[model samples]
Target chain A: MNISIKRKDQGDHRFLVAVSGEIDVFTAPELQKGLLPLTEIRGGTLILDLNETRYMDSTALGVIVAALKSASRHQCSFSVTGMTPRIQRLFEITGLMELLKRVQTSRGVAND
Target chain B: METQEDESQLSEYRTLLAHYISQKDQKLPTEESEHLRRQLHACGILPEDLLGLHIEALKGAGIFSESAMMRSLNFLMKMMSGYSKAYREHQELKDWQKQLDTELDIASALQKTLLDGKVPACSFADIGAISEPAKRMSGDYYRIVNDGKRLVVTIADIVGKGIPAAMCMSMIKYAMDSLPENSQGAPSYILSLLNRVVERNVDTNMFITMFYGVYDPETGIFSNSSAGHEPGFYYSAREDRFMDLEARGLSLGLAREAEYKEYARRIYSGDMIFLLTDGVTEIRKDHDFIEREQIVALIRRWMHLPAAEIVKQVMRALKKMQDFSLQDDFTFIAIKF
Candidate 1:
């Protein structure tokens, strides 16, 4: 029902978003505001931290998926990390984990 | 109660009920009993509606002893109060999962009969399906019926839960069974007929979402229809990607004259149709839940396996995601052509 989102710039247009609290249907809209703009950071990296996120629903997941898709279209680097086991299960069930893994693998290859 | 026909039927029922009430060793003849039931239904009467009044008449006549009637009344009152309390708790707490009584138990049994339906063997299409309830009673219902020439699969979720929801499901099952299944572009027709039934008889607060599809082997075309159900996926083997199987309509019972449109695709080799209830995608653990994309991935990963095996693996993955504890009824069908 409650969510807190803090955005920090890592310079060079790189941003790290730390999200915490419960993100069910009621609060997914708020998450959308904090995450979508950063997704279009063109030539920069967007990292979302869900370590403090205690809960999330399908609506919130949709927001994240939208951000993921938007980032891909913009050709910006996007990454997600710090998922609790519970949150991890959510991603795993949604096939987002596989998508994220593919991105990470591609990013790793590009970096090398 | 006012019509001459009703009066005549009432007199007959009065004679039958009175005799039955007085004599413990007598049985109503089957034809007569069926006629009485049909007449009662036609008169918008339930048997219980007549029983109390009949009992009062018999008591006044001193034909029935007071003790047995008092005991029956007391028992009925007790069950009524129990049901009232259970319903109250259910509403206040947002917990619609409680199985109210023997009626709900019977409804749950009927739901299992739907699950036990066999997928008709099709040389061109292989089908796999299963439905699991989160509790003793399930709001989700799926049935796979072979119409001799084509296979028809129906997946539905009642908006409300418990006995009433299950009863609606039974009505749907029978109604689907009686439909002319072999007609081309009949998926929409089937949903419209079902929608009329739900709108007329079901409670105002209750509605149902259904996805129905008929697969034709000769043309390899699977035409589908939806009644406010989530759109499923159609995997195109040639394209090597999944596409949404799109069709639109209001949920059944929302509007008496609701219309569902048909969507069709030629299911080529390696193509499959995937249909499911929201329970599979909305599964929430402590901090997270699964979604449609995750399910699509599960299917894509298992595409090479047998259709039945693909459905089973998806079920297993969903169970694991929810930590082997379901929060809702899970039912899905995978059809490969």
Candidate 2:
């Protein structure tokens, strides 16, 4: 998987992370390593772009949920964007849609 | 006090030295040489008078000294040390990979021994089961124990696969063994006990889905309970229809106080119960899953055969449909009456 994190600007604390490729039990740890620290940045916003992600398993969902919990503790705003329909169904079936924030685009500027 | 001709010659020498220093490839003096020359100039020696002596020193021993050669030698030594360090790390990584492979092999063997143990011989039911892991080891488990009167059968699938899931299977095996013999007939009680053991021992992130059933040879009664397991199929020869064996419960280890409900049915001759892990039902086709109805239809096509033959035929069909490589472990158990 490829995970790239880009800060919005010099003064802005918001970060945009784009993830691509499969995220299964074996590869979720790499995603977690890239995402977990962003959750701890106080008062920051994290926008995860999963437009290119073809597949993800339950372990990957767990990693995302863990990041959400950490983001909550640090008062960071976290949202996921551009999920495929199949991926959306998986999130709904696992009942993770209720826990995670979803947005329409990578910018995540629109109000929910 | 120099003569006019000697002073003129010295001025000419200074001009030549300045011109030489301006040339790119002249190999200028190092900072150390400049420092020494400055100290000499401060002590009242003219820079122009020292130019010829400095040139001679540079040619003889200053820039080409033993210390300069030692510096180059030291750099080569450092490069060699770095290479050796990288080589050692590569060898250590290879050794670690070898060690992990061996350990996984041993664990896989032990898991096979536990799973392929003797199945109970009962007149009321003929059972056949198979567990095929997608990787080197499986996370699926099944065991049938005969307690002289009734036979107890249990099948479970851990949420993950490979070594960690195999380890959880081992923990489940021991926990099953430790259950009281009296609890074998009560599926809910058995699952509740197992849930406590799993909740206490297994990692919270992981959970297991299980189906536990007890069969009585004398009465042809099959009582079963489920812990968030997939709903198995029940084919009745008399009714000529398939029924779903559904129960309500949370997956094991999800919650400490989760309760499982029991269901019972009488098995007549030619009746069969088909139990399977999600691996069989959730086969991937492009971006979608192979429909469960397709699997049920495949079972119906071979419903007339014995339990073992039915399992074999269904697995063969699935293998052909999947192009012989499953994405996850495939486990199925069939009980024919």
Candidate 3:
């Protein structure tokens, strides 16, 4: 249940978040707190690094999906990196990998 | 034993009680009662200390003078005795529970073997399935109905255990049995009917994640739907790739007004439809769990075998991967068309 989240502002509204530790129901709220606001980075990229994250449940997946949706609405680009095989497979199983793959990879698009 | 501070507080309480009795005709303010509660707490009187006070009053011995008899022994002794009795009853209940669990396990096995009959035969597709419980009972349930031209397979990952979960599965099976035969075509329609049964009967905490797929051998189309279950896989032997069986819906019994969407895929010759529960993919490796891709890789590795043989081979490898000790119920069904 020990999750560590660190956020760095890359200037001009761009952000990089590095998350490590277990992400279950207990720690998902903490992750949501760290990821949601940065999704509003207009015309910027929000890169989420989950390489050191050990475990995650469906709840954490939901949080990430919500963050992706928020980013899309704000015209911010979103992408995930540093997923271990175990974590990557979780995304695949829940059908979120398909969604993640479709997430707008370009730098900016105007929100309608 | 009473602390020195508690002994002093007791004298103070006694003096106050004597004063109250002497002025019995006068009404004390409500604040005085609150003050007494605080004073008792300040004197380290535990919640169970009242038992000692009550015992003292019943004896009318006024043995506070002896002081030695006025400590927490009364509370501890009574609590210990009560706890001892409760522990004995708990052990007895566990024994009865063990007995009930065994009987239920037998009943469930018999239900699978004797009652529902065998998995119906499909002329064009070879079907293979295996459901193994981590405990004496399995909460995971699967039902396959094949009527030559059409095959409807439903797999559910129930969120409960033992008698309640088994009984729920039985009820669901009965409901499915009673539905009209034509209802088999629309996976969404069948799921809605099952959803009503689950919403009304199953406990609020117990929800079910299920995938219902109806395959037509004549048309080679497999129409499917999901109820918050894991996305299944469709393997194309010619393409050498797996397409995500992505259908989204709320978990059964989550809400009475839930809606499920349907998806259709063309099943070509040598293509396989794979549906499974979390138990299989969540199988552990030391501290971490195996992912769904590993299962996909396993299927691809043994792609040349018949559907049934591939199932057995994948299970054998998975069993060894986890060293024969499963942490949850492992249930999966594969059909090669």
Candidate 4:
């Protein structure tokens, strides 16, 4: 499966990147590469969109965990948006929901 | 190296990307937008590919604005990476399965070679032997050697099971090969040599039960000795009955100088001699022993059958009694004169 990245401005220091695909061991590195730079910059919030993701495995879970650590180190808040039930359940199984902020849609950031 | 922290960071970042991509008109600060623009560019999707179609899409939607192109690009990069991870995992699983299948094939071939041996011919005897090792390997072996005037026949079963027993059986075959050409002189003499060979090399817990004999096909007379093996059966079509031959020696590998009693039998046409391991009569049926009655019943039915057919029938009956599962290696050898 191929993943696509879309960028958008979410307020003054928050950038949103939407992701869609089946995330697993093969594609996790691509997800990691896309998020590593933003966390390096240390301030902008990254809103990850996973609503279109139909399935994910343990390696995909690893990618998500890596992104969370990078954000915390940079002191930038990380939020998940547009989580489909499948993605939501994965996050629940991995206990990722407990550690990261989650929202129904990226649209809320614009009003803020 | 920083796997733990990197994983945590990746999760946090994905959460934001999830949020960012869903926003229809989200605006990032100028610096943040540029940073995300570069991240998307690194994924091999040019900024224009993400933006070109979205620019028209935004204008047509009426809710579209200048920031639409950047948001679209960021979303596309996340999708590509997610797909890459899935592809790699599928390949890994396929490779692992292939490796497992190859190993299983090699193990099967090695087991077959260790259990089967070449059959030697004798002028006066027509010998037939067969062994089945269930699902895994087992310790059932039979050998026939033509020693000039006498035909030497040996059938043995190693105690215990699996690959270990098969290994010990191989060692025993090698020990037999080392014996003198005229070694069938006496049962006790041969057993003394065999016991010394086994006890010197094998673990104390390992042992073997064997029935060895010499036959003069010209005279139709057989002389034999047993080392803790099951009593053999001699079937006479003329008499229409089966007689049990005594097993008159201690098991091999237990002690040196083990005594064995010699027995002789004269055979006529339509006379049959059968040698069996415990796995035959010891077959379990409804949690009860199959015993001598069932065995005699089977032999009576197939007394006139060919040697192969007789062995096959016994195996079939044993399988039926064990509910189609043969838990041990079942081996038998038969000679007709």
| RMSD to truth, every model | 21.0, 14.6, 10.8, 25.2
TM-score of 4: 0.52
True contacts kept of 2: 0.06
lDDT of 4 by residue, A1-112 (tens): 7777677776777788777876654576787788767755556678788777655543455566556656666666678888776456435522356446432123235335
Off by over 4 Å in 4: A1-112, B1-104, B117-123
How large a fraction of the reference contact set does each model reproduce? 0.00, 0.06, 0.04, 0.00
Ranking 3 against 4 by TM-score, winner: 3
Q: What interface root-mean-square deviation (Å) does model 2 yield?
A: 4.3
- DockQ of the candidate models in sequence: 0.02, 0.13, 0.07, 0.01
lDDT per residue for candidate 2 within B12-67, as digits (tens), equals: 43343443344455443345334443444454554345545434333423334455
User: Which residue pairs in candidate 3 collide?
Assistant: none
Model 1: runs farther than 4 Å from truth? A1-112, B1-107, B180-185
- What is the alpha-carbon lDDT of model 2 when measured against the actual structure? 0.72
Each model's interface RMSD (Å)? 12.0, 4.3, 7.2, 26.9
Q: How high is each candidate's TM-score?
A: 0.53, 0.64, 0.57, 0.52
Give me the iRMSD of candidate 4, please. Answer: 26.9
lDDT of 3 by residue, B116-196 (tens): 525667788888888776665666788888776688888887655455556666777777778986564488887877888
Models ranked on DockQ: 2, 3, 1, 4
Write down the worst ten-residue block by lDDT for model 4 chain A.
A102-111
Per-residue CA lDDT of model 4 for B1-337, tens digit only, reads 5566444434434444445655765543335545554554454554455545344333433335446446655554543443455568868988998897776567657867755555566445456677887546667778877868778878888765666677888898888878876764676677667877875777544567788887886777888888767778887768967898765665566544456678888877778788887678656688566777788788668656766677778778778889988866788777766
